[model samples]
Every structure is written in structure tokens, then in C-alpha cells.
Target chain A: MALHPYDPVAGAALRNVPLAEVDSKDRSLALSRPWQLRPSLLASIASHGILTPLRLRPKQNGLMQVVHGFRRFEAARRLGLPSIPGLVLASRNLLKLFLQALEEGRTARTLSSLENAAALRTLKYRFNVPEKRLIEEFLPLLDLKENRRTLRLHLDLAVLPDALQQALERGLENETALRLSGRPEDFQSLCCRLILSFQLGKNRQKKLVEMLDEILAAASKQEVQSVEEVWRELGCAALENRADLTPADRWKRILALLRQARYPALSRHQARFDELKAALKLPPPVRLQAPRYFEGSSLEISMTVREARQLDGLARELKRISGSQEWEELFRLL
Target chain B: MQPYKPEKVFVERAVAESVITRNVLGNLPMAQVEWIDEAGQMVDKSRRWNPSIARAKQSLVLARHPGRFFKPCPAGTTKTGRRNVCCNYFVVNFASNCHMECSYCYLQAYLNLPYMVVHANVEDLLDELGQVFSSNPRSHYRVGTGELADSLALDSLTGYSRPLVEFFAGFTNAALEFKTKSNCVENLLQLDHRGRTVVSWSINPPTVVQAEEHKTASFEQRLAAAEKCSAAGYPIVFHFDPLIHYPEWEKDYRSLVEEIFQRIPPRSVPWVSLGALRMPPRLKALVRERFPRSGLPLGELLPTEDGKLRYFKPIRVEMLSKMRAWITAASPQTRIYSCMENTDVWQKVFQSQQPPSEVELGDSLLQLL
Candidate 1:
């Protein structure tokens, strides 16, 4: 096989380059930044300096571009080191250098979700890789399915704002973030804020996003120029932004408002059921449960007692409840 | 309606000399045809294409079905493991995918093969059916060709109905039903069906036909075709299988029922089937993705025990009961049956009468035929 003069595997050699000559600003091939470096890594670098050499290619302007070690270079930079060891490659092929750096980046550590997007974006927009090739070749390389849908989703994630990308790194789901990426910037900001503040679980996060999307899609165009206005119109704005309420309470309130708006009939039935159950005034130990979605015409009654003596009182309460008018009203609700 | 003219056609090497292949290729003089060693590879690769399901429909495949062609109707037992009061119906799948794009088509999620396939080996299908039917002379089998594909959607190209109609005419123990949403009845108009083939249309209100049933016949076109079939001595049936619910559904469905009775003689209408809109949950996402402007996904749907989503019980009951009332008011003699519904729904819709058993229902329909 033909070999180039600046082959990264064969021709590359380690050299100590000065911090001034090494340009870390050009991160066109970087998969991740050094934003949240572990304190252990910082202490290691502080004690022993950089143990591994960074990959750098010489630019035409005579400055060495950091190719694969932004995190290590950043550690040395913060430690105030004069110079760091790096492998210098003089290849004229920028794409080859980028791929070499990508391989080295993968070998060093597992790339975060956002870093995967970054690598895909660099291959796509920067190198002008065709979508078909990305879907077939690069997606599998990045541990994703080989399909146009996966490619589009990664590309969409790559283009979101930095805050949203960081949120993805910090536990926001890829699918939920992708759904938000297509919406207007204001809407994305609002939803991201809600998601982070509430500390919602995965299911609640998905439900919140889906409910918001459905409500927005069903709104009249002229009436909903802004998502905030829709929130205000639906009476969720004040409840969500209430300072005294806990995050759980706020999420519950917002979800209730959205559910009521989205499914008026189902919510109305639920409200009536709640009212009838309240009117029944069953004993605290006894519970009356309606069927799911009121899909069936049956109701369940259960009682929890700490002692056997409580059963007599519970049975008397149940007997009284069976003859109550509210019991019939509850059945009618079903 | 625009005639289905696929941009390309893939013909498997095995079926290159089949009659259905020859007829279909002969009909499509403008299509670019490619011969492949096998159909499964090409159909499998088609799913990887961009906009997989929609793009797959732009091409057609004429291949031999490599498996059994006859099976019991899957609609009898839903995916959720709840068995409905199923008519003893059988399905003869002559095709794999449908060309007409309905927003709520189960094929969007149910079928792994995205491209439309026409099984060209009709003689094998006939021979298998002959053995099954002749072996059981006392058993009456009610079979349909519309399980996986529309019965008459590709009739002009494949000309499958002629052979099927002629074959079924020779069997006194079997009846063939050509269920479709298309008005493509020209092929069956002159066939000697001999009181064996029942031409059925899956009818909806014009509003639904316009909004959801893309690239299919209009209400008037289907009614006209049904009238023509009745005049040609074939029994006619209507299926309101997916009775979509909306604010004005009652008025629209009532008008639809009244118009059918007003035009065609109700005596010729042996039975009409009512089924509410129920689909696998995955199909809901596909419908929402394909037809964003459609209101189908916005309805009040809940997951039933069958693992398919349907309108809430009261909503379904209201829609089906009102539809049953309208049809009964139109023609008291025409029988009404619920398709894929439980005993409770049947009792409510048929009020005061007991729900029929599967054998009883199947036998009653066969007796009418």
C-alpha cells in the first residue's frame, strides 16, 4: 500500500511543542471540550504533568493545531505548564487527520452523546460527507443504527444550542432533546428550563414534551404565536412559576392543566368521579377505585386494617356506603 | 381517482413466465422493469430507503409467495390476546402490501415488506384451494382476498379476479369476497361469478374518504360500482369497518347509510358490518408522522386489552350503536353485524338480543350467501 510522508501511525513522532505555538482554538475535529474535567484528572496532571501526548497537525500558518487531546491540553493549560508533548503530523489531507483524531478520541474514552453529535456534524457539514455515506458508514462507527432516520436525528441534535446540548450530556434524553430541537427557540428554552427545574424522571419528561407538542399542534395558528402565550392561556404559567410550591407540586399542577386541556372529556369524567368519591365520604381505611379510564362499568372497594378488630368498623362503613346515593352516582359516572 | 402507475416494477426470475406477471407487465407499458434473482432481498433493501414506507410504495414487485397462501383471519384474535366473536373467516393473501395510502392503514406497521407485492403464482393458489375445498365437501369456507391488499386496487393490472372468480364458481362449498375501497369493478363485471363471489366495498363518509383514504375512489364512485355489481347478479356488501368518530360523525354516517339504501335496493344488500377504528399503537405514530394535518390521531383513543388503541368504550359504543340504528332504520331486512367486537359491545348494539356465537354468526352469513 502507498504511504504518505505524514502518516499518523508510521511517520508521526512525539515532540514537545510550546503552548504558544499550539493552537487549541481550532477545534474543527474535536469531539468534546474540557468543560467538566474530573478533579482526579486535574490532580493527576498537576502532580505528574500530561502522561499521554496530544495529537497535533502542523498548519500552513506554522501553528500546531491540537487534533485529539483538547481535554489534556486544557488540563496542562490550566496547570500553567510551559509546553506539553504531542505527536506532530504534517499531512495535507485534513480529512485523514480528522479521522485519525476521531479514532484516537474513541480509544481514549467513551464519547458522550453530544460528542457523538459533534463528530457526526464535523464529518457532515465540515467535510461535506454525503448523507448516504453518513447513514451507511459513519453511523455504525459511532454505535448507531445505519438508517436515514438516525442520521437525521443526530444531525438535528448536533445543531441545537449549547445549553440544550449540555442538558443532553447531563441526563436529558436524546429523543426528547431531538423533539425540542425542531421547535422554535423560545419554546425550546421554556421546555428545557421546566425539565431541569422539575428534576422529572424519564417518563414524566417524555410525557411533558408530548403533551406540550400535542397542545401546541392543536392550537389555532393565529392564537398561538408564542408558547408562553399558550401557557398563559391554559393557566399553567402562574402555577408553574409559583415560588412557594415545590418542584414536584409544580410538575403535578402543570401536568394536570395540560391533561385537562388535551383531553377535556376524559378529564371531565375524572373530575365527576373525584367529586362523587368525595361525596361518598368513605372511611379513611376504605378506598373506592374506579376502573382505568372508566372503560368498564365496575368499581373496586378495598380496605386496609392494622388489626382484626378494625374489620367490624370497616364492614359497617362498607354496608353504609353500599346504600348511599353517591355510590349510585359513582356507578353512573362509569 | 388517479390510476395507480408505479414508477418502477421488480419481477422475480421465478415468476417471469407466470400469467399474472405477464398481465401486469403488459399493463404497465410506461414503467421501468427490472428482473431480480429473488424478491425478498429487494423488498428488504427497500425499507432502508429514505422515508421507507412511502418510498417503498413507488415501486411494485411481482413475485411468488414462498409460503402458504391460505390462513385463518388474524382479526379474530387481536394482538392483546383477547379473542373476539370472530366469524369463521379465511384469508387468501394474493399480495403483500397495498398501493393506496390510508392514514390509519395497519400495513404501515404490520407489514415488514414495504413494497407492494403481487404473488404471480395464481395456479398454485388455485390448486391448493381446490384440494382444501374438495377434501371437505360438507364444510363451507368464507374466504376473502383483501386481507393484506385491497381486492380490486390492482385488478386492472394483475387481472387476478378473473381466475379467482372463475375458480370459485366451480365450488359450491366456498364463497369468495373481493373487499376493497376502490371502484375497480370493470374486471368482475363480465365474469361468470355464478352467485359465489360477493363484491364488497369498505365504505366511509365522503368527508373521511377525502381526508383519510388517499388515492382511492370517492363515495359516489364506490356506490356506482356496487350498483353495477348488483345488477350483474353478484351479491353486494358494505363494511363500515373503521367508523371514525368526530363531532359531526353521527350526521355524516346517517347520511351515508341513507344514501346507500336510497340508491341500491336493500334486498340485494345481504349484510353490513360495523367496526370502530382500532389500530396497533405503533400505527398511531406512523399516521401522525405521515399525515400531520389529519385529525385521526387527535381523537380520544385508549389502549384496549387487545393491545390496539380504540375510542373509549362510551365513544365506541355511541358511534357503533348510532350506526347500527341508522342502518336498521334504512333496511330492516338487512342484517347488521359487529366486526371484531366483544360480547358486551354486541349486546349493547343489538340490545335485548344475545350476542351470537362464532359458529352461529358464521353459519348465518353462509346461509344468507
Candidate 2:
């Protein structure tokens, strides 16, 4: 079979291919990059056809498979075009095809972490690329560590459910998504929805995931049978009426609940400390502070006095407070 | 003695020419060896480093000490006394991690590096210690090597204990303790320590050992090894630290104490310390993550004033007081102290809030010498 030379450098050829006849099957091996119909791009293509041709290979059927230009093909189909311009190729080399598509995609727009993971997965399973080569050669090519542990983590993220994977693509950090994936499947979906809807940043996302993990650990220790029961036990309904609260405030409340569940003793100590601090209302100038974590045996009371009169006033207040039973109880708590 | 078998050996280029490095490499012939330069680049760098899985599977690393070899132990203060009570206690860093997988081990959180690293420069460590001992002629020093790594777990591979024991033998005022849960004492048996070396075992009930201490010697094996060391004229110490509160804990602990006194003479065991189970708040998550089935973190723990989670004061007092009585009945002459315990706990357990000062403690320990 004498085939014409396909420009490997430019890697595209202009040809008319029927939109209906372009086979998008076998896309399981295509890097599963998320596609959203950007109105601007659609309108531009609608006004003046696709400037770049779709990359396609002839299938066993009469149809040609669109390998690199999924978005352009979809837009052409939406515009009711009978045929679109495409780059005709004559090879079934999956690895070569993937690299070309990835290169073109990279030049056009930045690929998300999940997109990179999908490409790595295709190279791994479809091309049978060894893990060593994938981590050392291919991952560094994608600006990732040449380490097996990190490769495995990303590959795990690639196989997550669509909603979670989409959330990861939407700006969740790889580590945060991985942490969420550690939860039970149903709980992972719920967390993914909450995280995406709330639009949490990296720090808040990490906190939410950590709080979820702590709550789950406590529930598991208590032998709670279901996630619903755990959520109910945490009184998650209280968050419903907090519509006025900002996302950070809501996250703080959720964290407080998890902290109370995880460290009941610390919570009790904090409550007691707060009560004591409120009851012992000394002068505003006299600052009283308890040790952090209540792990110390002393409370620090301080006041800056510039005059002898001020010193005597402070001394008198201290003497009066020293006789109170609250002082005794506070020290005993310490 | 169990032989040290590391999966991969990384040598710093600065120490690649040292005899200890060569000897260690020659010992582990089958381990993959690579020389890393100052930039942390391996000579034959490949993508074969699977540190996470290898660490989980107990990989070991042999490297040189990068900086100072000795560090003074922190003068950990208690509620009663905010004083430096360590009394010249120091730790030598010959190793950085342990192979044993105790569920409650703080190393899971402390060590950032996954592989067990053994610092190969023992001569440098000895030289540094000799200077300290020579400069401070009047003070008695209690030095140990088990702070970061088990003392004897890799003694057979490195032969660290022999040189350490031999070094301390010449000093009448300094003592070296090899604290471990392993039964690797064959190297110690051959050395003429002259009572300068103390072999201490971190002991627990057999059930706890089986449930929590993975890959460590069984209680019976540990006690048998302790008896062997005692017979060899080495002062013996036992530490019942992190005493867990489990079902029928009293019965278990009592039997453990009885078993210890039955096998060896109590007079030979000079020091026995009891510390109830406690951990930093951050460590609980690590424990649960590493050992999912572990119930150690699910106990009735309370936050103390020191930011550590411990059993309630009354619970700790009861546990300590009961253990004290059992040990006293078994060996009245044995001196028992509490590790990291506060003044109130010491008072409640020992009937005296004013325990011996650091010098007094040092003098009493020297009596065993």
C-alpha cells in the first residue's frame, strides 16, 4: 500500500471528512480531557469555520476517526456542516497518535492534572508502557516527579468517578482530591459535590477533607453503620439555616463539629476555659490568658503600669480576685 | 542476632571512601548501592526508587552522619519542677528509624524519610564523645543510643555495640545504655563491658506485644535475652512504658511482672521505669492511618497541660500505683522511676513528690555500675 507522506512535523493535512462519518469510537484510549462548549469558541467557529483541521485516521469502517480534534468536530456537527476539514493519517500507532494529540492540545491550551493523568493512563494500559519509563520519562515531560509513588497517586485519581474527576479538573489540588478519594465511595461523591459547589481554595479544601476523615474515623470507632447516620449524629442540618454564613465560616463550623467529636476532652477544656475567662472579668487593661491546649499548669496575667498608683490599683484588684472561689477552680482545672 | 539486610544502600560521596561505608556495603552485597553527591543526585540514578513501598516493606539505608553526631537530651520538665532534670543525659545518632512497626510508635509521624537510615561514622561519634568525657571530668554522664533507633536491632550488621561498650569501659563516670525490644545481644555478649553497658528492654504484656509490636521479639524471647545479658555481668534495665489500658490490663501486667521476677533476679535489674500510654495529638491520626485495626488510639485519653494525650490523672495514678505494688512485692530492692511523669503522679505513686535530684539519681544509678 503506497501511502502519501503525512507531514510529521506539522502533523496535519487538509481534507474534507463527513462529520457523520468521522468515527469517535475507540475514544477510550483518547486522553479523556474535559470538554465544555465555550460560547466564544463556538461563535467564532460558526462565523468562519474551524481554522485548524481535525486530526483523523481511517477506521476499519468507511468512517474516519477524529483523534485530536474532538472539540472542533463537535462544533462542526453543531453548525450542521456536511463535512469538515481534517488531517488525514494512515497509521494506527496508539502511542504516536496520543503524543501528537497531547502536543497539539498543549500548544492550544493548558491541560489540567486530570488531563495529564488520563494521557498517562492511556500510555500505560493502551501502549503497555512500563511504570519506570512512565514515571522517569513521561511524567517529567508533564512537569511531574519522576517518582513511582506520585505516579500511582495520579493514576488513581484518573480512574475516579466522573463527578470527582470533574471536580479535580475544576481546580481542586491533586492531593486534596486524593484525600477525598480515600473516603467511602458514596461519601466521596458527597464531598466532591460539596467541595465543587462551595468553590473551596486549597487550604479550605484540605481542612474540609481532614475534618471529614476525622469524623469518619470517630464514626467507625463508634460502629456507626452508615454515612447518613454519621452525618445526622453530627447535626449537619444546623448548617442548612446558615445561608448567611460565608463558605469559610461554614467550613469552620464543620471543623468545630469534627474537632468536638475527635477530641471531646479538649472541647470540654476549651469550654471551661472560656467560662472562666468570661467570669473573671478583670479590668480591660489587665490581660489574662490561659496556656494553649491547657497543657500547662499556669495562667498568665499581665498589665502594663506606668505609675505607682496604677501598680497599687492592679495589686488591689489581684488581691480581691485571689479570694474568689473561681480563681481556685481555675487553677484546679489547670 | 538477626543480620541487617537493607534493600537499597545509598552512600554519600563524602563518606564513600570511608572504611565503615565500605564494610557496610561489603556486608550487604545484594543491596542496590548508589553514591549520591552533595546535590542529592545519585551516580546511577534510575527510576527504581520505590521508597514508599520499600519503607512499608522495611527497607534500610546506610549513610554517613552529615553533621554533629551527638545531641543533648532535652531537660523535659514536669509540672512540679521546671528544671533541667536530665542530668547530663545525651543521645548518639547512629541510626534514624526503626524496622519494628509498633502501632503507637511516634516515629511514624516524626521521621520524614521513609527508609531506615544508619549513620556509618562511628569513629567520629566516639571521637566527639571522648572530647566531652575528657572535658567534663567531674560529671557522670548517662548516654544512650536508643532515642531515635532501636539500639540492638542492627547491632549485628553494624557491630556498633562492641565499640560503644569498649569505649565506655575505660570511663568510670560514664555509662552507655542500649535500649531495645529485640533479642540481638550476641554482639554484647562477646564484649567486656565491665558493667559500663546497660541493656534495657521496653517491656509490655504478651497480649499487647502480640497485638501492637510488629516484628519485635516476643515477651518471652526478650526476657530470655535479658537474662543472658544479666548473666554476662551487664546491668539490666526494664521499661514498661506506654502501658496500655485494655481489657483485664491489671491481670496481664501482673503476670508480666511476675514472669520477669521469675526468670531473673530482681537485684540484677537495677532500674525499672513505668510510663502510661501517651502521645501527641497529631500522632493519633498517623496511628489510625498506618494501622487501621489498631485500637490503641481509641482509648479513653485526655489532653494534658503539655499538649499530649494521656490517660486521665486518676487512671494513670491507679495504673502506676498498682504496678508499683506488684513490682515491690516481686523485687523490693529494685528502684522504679516514672518516665516523663509529673510531680503529682510521682507523689501519688512513690509516696514522695520530691523525688531524687538529678545528681542523686545519677549517683543511685552509678551504684549499679
Task: Judging by DockQ against the true structure, name the best candidate.
Answer: 1
Q: Which segments of model 1 are wrong by more than 4 Å?
A: A1-25, A33-55, A61-64, A69-88, A91-110, A120-156, A159-163, A221-225, A306-309, B47-51, B352-354
Q: Against the hidden reference, what TM-scores do the models get?
A: 0.88, 0.74
What Cα-based lDDT does every candidate model obtain?
Answer: 0.85, 0.76
- What are the per-residue Cα lDDT tens digits for candidate 2 across B113-226? 666777877788899989988998987888889988999987766777878899999898789989999999988887889888899999999899988998889998899999
lDDT digits (tens) for residues B185-280 of candidate 1 = 999999999999999999999999999999889999999999999999998999998999888898899999999999889988888899999888
TM-score computed on alpha carbons, candidate 2: 0.74
Q: What is the overall TM-score of model 1 with all chains considered together? A: 0.88
| C-alpha lDDT of residue A243 in model 2 | 90
